[model samples]
Target chain A: MKNIKVLGSGCANCKATFARIEKVARAKGVAVTLEKVEDFAQIAAYGVMSTPGVVIDGKVVHAGGIPEQQQIESWL
Target chain B: MFEQFAHFLVYQLGGLSPASQLGTALHFWVMDTTKILVMLVVVIYFMGLFRTWLSPEKVRRVIQGRSKTLARILAVTLGAMTPFCSCSSVPLFIGFVEAGIPLGITFSFLIASPMINEVAVVLLIGLIGWQLTVLYITAGLTVAYVGGIAMERFHPEKWVEAYVWQIQMGEIAQPAIDTSLRGRHVFAVSQVTEIVGRIWLWVLIGISAGALFHGYVPQTWVAGLSERENWLAVPMAVMLGIPLYSNAVGVIPLAEAMLAKGVALGTTLALMMSIAAISLPELLILRKVMRVPGLLLFVAVLMVAITLVGWLFNLLN
Candidate 1:
């Protein structure tokens, strides 16, 4: 199982990224656990200043803006 | 229209005396708030559209492998145009370093990124006037350009930690931006609501302070300070502002309040720039990439540059 976390303050980009992750996971039939981290302190703890960060297994794979769907699929 | 609306609200419906404290405060609040919010929406929206066309990644691609002189120019201009924040500092720094951009050019971008941007200029125009706005932009760019060149000439790379050069990051592809008019509308509206929501309290606080100054503080007092023209004011303001962290927008109200209270224009501008560009948190974050000496040197260079600009403006005014 893959632990995937989407980090943001619930901005439009964050919501879009969250939706994209779910859609990509469902399409790929991957059993991934997902979570949204909304707290700024927690986001800072991850050493990410920008929002809409995608962390896979504790590694910040992407930070700032929405990642491409193809790139999300690759990360999945 | 803005003045009329404020007049109508207070004088017509509320029937408050313009001579009264409440009346004056409400009038100031209504007029300033409307002007700022209106500008915020129009400017932020168009800026969003502009941002969609010129992403930071694209900026990185263009600056990469360019000559030092050209890189310095692009870095200053693009850094001002690009929408970036302190949170992106580490990654942005790393990205530039990895792209083979020289330390000097990278320093220019880093210095300019937080200092000069559309939001600050728009707010300055709304609150102050066009003359100061132009001065702010030109001074800010000059600081970044000169500071970058100075740092580059000095060669402070030795103070960088060994690990900063070793960290590697692969570029993640960006999603396509919605460039349609409708898309820009949505983006702009969202930006307005988000920014307005976050800063409304500060805006109110600022207006309240301004109102207080307007009603209670004697004009003679401010003029008195100007007449005395304390030499330490500019340097003190720069020092006080550096440790405080804030964005260009968040600091507008306070800047307006200070100016309303008769602070020197150069001193007020210096305070805002320091708050926007330098902060303890930002310095701590940069700690990962630079040693204490390099960090101190960076601070010293910026402080000197900012102080000079402030003094020059004060002299001219």
Candidate 2:
């Protein structure tokens, strides 16, 4: 199972990012523990300034926008 | 030329009469949209390439221990250069503060990030002209500089939410970004796609509104507001703009329309700045990180500064 975190401040983009990650993971049948990090402190701690930053297993894989499906597939 | 193309499409091909209001409005919309979109793609791609070298983390690192004056200058300049989304403002704020960057300098970055950017500059040039675009950029940077200084005098540090100071930032490894030539090209292309995708609707709305205003609104209707004696127009424009949440891209075309209807340059510029800079939604987002007093102070400083800029330009013009 992969531990994935979506960091954002509850903006529309953040919500969309969270949804997309879930959808992609389910489709790929990848076992993942997904969490949404809304706290600014935690987000800043990760050094991700842009919202909807994606962190996979303690590694920030993307920031600033929704990740493309191919990128998500590669991660899975 | 875009004008000739628009003329041909609207009149020659579409078979609309040149003198018709629909024809004129359609022509204006088509010409302006085509020109603005083309300029946006080229400019945003270049800006995206430039931005690979400058990120918020990098900006924080550079400004962390600098002298006050130098830091403020750098903050404003980098703020304009950094392609930041308003959604990220809270984290950006906390990140800067956590890094020991002064509150004033952080405010400078916050002010400039939204108010002056490649999209705003490109749209201003496409809609109005380079002269006003230059003035707008100058005025934006000046406001950011002075506003930072002004906010510092109030000891804004005291007004921040206590929770912000309590949270400890961890040492997370920076993700290695692809910086190869092809990687830069891919980044630039994505930027163009994302930005154009996000703003195309707003652009169309703004241009269509301008087109309608151009086709129907009489010059005499706006003459009273544009008249030299009506000094209230500048301040009023600023106040009216605060609630009308829009980015700079969405406001410039409407500004061009107002200018065409004989509105004073100062009034139009003031409205554009206010709409682009001091938005209610952005303020609400900031409020989560700041106390009411701090939020009020930020808004007050921006309102006063923008109003002053409006008046100054009005007086000069």
Evaluated on chain B only, what is the TM-score of candidate 2? Answer: 0.90
TM-score for each of the candidates = 0.82, 0.91
lDDT of 1 by residue, B70-178 (tens): 9899999999998776656665676667667888888888889889877777777877778988988988898899888888767888987776676544543342456
Which stretches of candidate 1 lie above 4 Å from their native place?
A: A1-31, A34-51, A55-63, A66-76, B18-21, B167-172, B179-184
The 0-to-1 C-alpha lDDT of every candidate, in the order given, reads 0.78, 0.86
Q: How much native contact recovery, as a fraction, does model 1 achieve?
A: 0.03
Judged by DockQ cut-offs, the docking class of candidate 2 is medium
lDDT of 2 by residue, B1-317 (tens): 99999999999999999899889889988998899898989999999888777788788889989999999999999998987778889988988888889999999999998888898898788777899999999999998999999999999999898888876666643434568988778878988998889888877787777778878887688786555547898889989998898888778877888887788888898898899889888888898789889988998999899989999998899
Instruction: Name the candidate that leads on TM-score.
Output: 2
For the predicted complex of model 1, DockQ is: 0.15
Shift in Å, residue B89, candidate 1: 0.4
Please count the clashing residue pairs in each candidate, in the order shown: 1, 0
